[model samples]
Target chain A: MGILGVILAVTNLVVVVCMHISFRQYGKYKEHMILGVTLSEEQVKDDEIQCLLEKYRKSFRKYIIIGYITGILVIIPFEWYVSIALILYLVWMFGYIFLIQHIYVKYHKKLYAIKKQKGYTYGKIVNEITIDTKLSYAKDKMPVSPGWFLPSMLVFLIPLSNKGVREFILSNLQMSCVFIGVIVLVKASYLLIYYMFAKQRSQVYSGNSDINIACNRVTKRGYSIVFVVASFFDSISFFMLLWDEIAMGSMTMVGVLLFVVMQCIIVMGMVVGLIQIKKKRESILAEDSQERVVDEDEFWATGFYRNPMDNRLLVPDRQSDMNMTLNMAKPSAWIWTAGIGIGTAVLLLWTSVVMLRLDFVPVTYQVADKFEIIAPSYSKTIEFDEIQWVTLLDEFPDIKASKQNGAATDEYALGRFHIRNEGTCYLYIYHGYSPVLELQLNDMKIYCNSREDGVIQECYQQLQEKLSE
Target chain B: MIFHLNMSSETPIYVQLRNQIVLGIGRGDLLPGEALPTVRQLAEDIGVNNMTVNKAYQILKSEGYIEIDRRHGAKVAKHQKDDKEFEVYLKDKMELAAAEAKAHGIELTQFMDYCREAFGVNEEA
Candidate 1:
């Protein structure tokens, strides 16, 4: 296999390894870490929780072993399709994880019910731990400042100031700045809002209040650091795209590699941070004597959280304090759920449509007082009066361009592209199909060709006849 | 003022919001001409639909409990002297309450006492 295939295989292997690690860590945390209860108290009520954890762990371990073994076995013979194998593995892993989580949740709910019935109290020694308001609401302890992301806008200026860069942005970097800007804005908003509202102490537990606050502060700082690091990586990526050498040829393979590495580092960083925070919190809890464990029975189910009793829509996820989960009872939650469901369905449908169009759709051109070009994703009609000039070219123009819409492959170019010299042009030319007809319209250009050379000639003759008339 | 909405209640959210605002006004918790949270802000905070909050605001506006401006969103309306129309409306509502109380076997005096307590008015001579 080629270098690309080898790289892909290695990446796939790394991803599988990461997934295994993450799942194992999550399972470990779920099994051992009782959120409110002390270790001694947890042991007292551990019958069902222990049974559930054992069952889940056994199944989880079995699945991972089978999955990895199968993946390795498949990769041995069909290494070229390593990426596909990795995807299948991922699907299997996620499906199993979901099933296990569901089972765990079911068992947990039953256990919680039993505990409630038996009058099992968690950390009932109420000790009022007075927390300094400054510690609770410290600005420095907040997550990444939104201001750190504003520098990303400098990418726009890089293109605007230089002529070569302007052409690159208009053609190569078309709307990428807009996309990146939107992402930065969204991340900034989410971080800012989450820090401002969601990070507030919901229920201050006894003895561990200081520890809880400290944990939150540390986690927030970690998230901020992660965000800053991610933003820095994004800036690097944006700059990488500006390199003309990288923009051309198989350098995109290198870019993909860099992206994969960045993702791995980020994921590892987050996991380590989470594990560290959890360890610290557990240590603090172990040392503390006075603990107040509220009955969190109605609040969480399995891993999923939904409290009909709680009025708030966005609640902190039980598994991860950093993330938010919908309170399913809320009207807004239902709306958001429906919206996401519909959005996913629509995306799947659109993707299917695009695939079908790409495979089956043919380019068609006609002249009836006006010149019109039609393809699956690219379609345009040019007024006869607006036609500036028409020329037949034997070779494809070596124009630097970026696709605005439609497909541009080695075999054919069927898209709206912002060409360096030609401006915005609709291309419907097969690379092998010689003698392409070029139309220079009032404000834009059109390149047209057909699979059959005779058809192109016929279209050219017809266009000439119409122009003469 | 913090509004507590019972999601499980048979009463609609808009009606609950309207009732709460009216109760707040009656309890002197919400002063006349006091600015209320904008419909969007209230809806987001409560995690309800914007239209639900808007509907509540509309009800308040029609009842002269709040006035809505394009720039300022919604605010409590300035207190006006009790008019004959308001007295008629109040009488109509009180009659309905009296009928309900009678159906429930509540005496007229007890119902009046309950109303007086709710209104925070002095016991009659």
Candidate 2:
């Protein structure tokens, strides 16, 4: 099941990636930048920036395709080796994204300021091009590279470092096992510290003009410590691994698995984050170029585009941009929230299957069966307004009267009322039953279990993107 | 000697360079018609963007502190011959000196004594 699950995950990722590439290529071919942006067309006179961006984007697409193809190609012949290679490749790309971007972004503005002082006319052009390539690199953070160094390095050193001693220590079996445990704890803490710093940084950036970002300075000390501490733990693990009889354990195996999975998630989170930073920088540059001079608030206002001609505002109807920004701002928040939601649903689904296998719960409930059942759509809808809740309760009263799941009622002084009706129910209606042991006539496919769960996931993803912005 | 600039100072490099050039003229460190550094050379020497040095040179030219020729680099302007302009310059210098002494908490009598000493005039009699 785990193998199948991994296969399915890879397949889904491939499909999503292909879709993204096609969409971007189509966008490029069409020469279609995003709409509702208020940038003056003249600000992009040279299109050197756009051309540079497109070049990187094309390369990114090619690499992504090649990486996936290689993963599949290699895996068919050599499963374990290829799997490890693919994981390592992804890890390397992720680290490359972070480190390279930090360097580029840190130096970009200073370089531009120098250019401006030299009477170089196209400061905006250089800045925009810098931003776009960074974005492209970020999106392609997981493209496979040649496998010789990737897995070997990941096994020994963390993805970002290539120090010989560190590599030796990391790959040591006993040290690696201990390092695995340390990594899990460090990563979990990293997520928290990253969240706090990101939130604080965003607030500071979004606040006032006098508060310059100091151009890629280490704004968050705690997050830096977390990263450093993780590396330190890796060093300790390397030393520990030097000892025999320490590397082989059920706990060690679990820790290694957990570390790999968490790292993968972190890579995904960072990709999402970089995309967001790219988006923010793009919009900010566009806005900056359009305006002759900007005050503080103008710097912070990024969502809507202003018309250069009539000075009319064009706001996007969709909330996708907001979601994208939020996700970029605090990807771990989105990851954790979405993970919890999806995890719970998946767990419940599995538990249901398990109960049937163990004869703990009946395969099907009869109409008269008086077992407590949870109604779908209980969690998704906003419970803020009393009237909305009342209306929901009025629509379905049977589940409302039950004591389980705490169907709370709220009526505001303004005469609005909300009553939760789906949290508790005494009876469930089942139309048919299928025996598990017998061969099923048609495959039992899962549909949307509940709109609330589905919507929450979407909202979480959207919120993640929004916060990143 | 032509004035030189220190670029790495937190103060605007151009302002520092400009002040130094002005002081060079006032202190006779730069003689009349002395050749100054070319904008490019000055920029390189100070480790500043060329535009900053150019801006300072432009200001110096406008103030008649220096002049530039197509073939030659910037040069200090010849010493002023107009009596009215020289009188105004001397008054401005004296005012500036008085302000400096006041800033240093020196009394008017001490300031006069310092001025007399600078002029080699003894007040013993």
Report the number of the highest-DockQ candidate: 1
lDDT (tens digit, per residue) of candidate 2 on A1-469: 2332254345435443533443343223111122111122343233554454455456556655655564444334223232343344444434434443343333333333333344434212210101111111122112222232223224434432646444434434353455557656654554544333332211112222222222122222323333334444443443333221123321233443444454444444444544454455435434442222211111122332222211112211211221212321234545765887699668655644432332222222111112111332121212121111111111122221211221211100011111132121222211121111110112111111111223323433433343344
Candidate 1 B-chain TM-score: 0.88
Residues B24-90 of candidate 1 have per-residue lDDT tens digits of: 7888777788777666556654556789989989988888899888986677788744678889999
Taking all chains together, the TM-score of candidate 1 against the true structure is 0.62
Q: All candidates' TM-scores?
A: 0.62, 0.26
Q: After best superposition, candidate 1 residue A89: deviation in angstroms?
A: 13
Model 2, position A428: C-alpha lDDT score: 21
How much of the real interface does each model capture, measured as fnat?
A: 0.02, 0.00
On residues A41-137, what C-alpha lDDT tens digit does candidate 1 reach at each position?
4554467657756765686677667656654454443343333443444444445556545545554565555566666654333212122222333
- How accurate locally is residue A230 in candidate 2, as Cα lDDT from 0 to 100? 45
Residues forming the 10-long window of minimal summed lDDT in candidate 2 chain A: A126-135
Q: Give model 1's DockQ, 2 decimals.
A: 0.03
Residue A331 error, candidate 1, Å: 2.6
The DockQ-based CAPRI class assigned to model 2 is incorrect
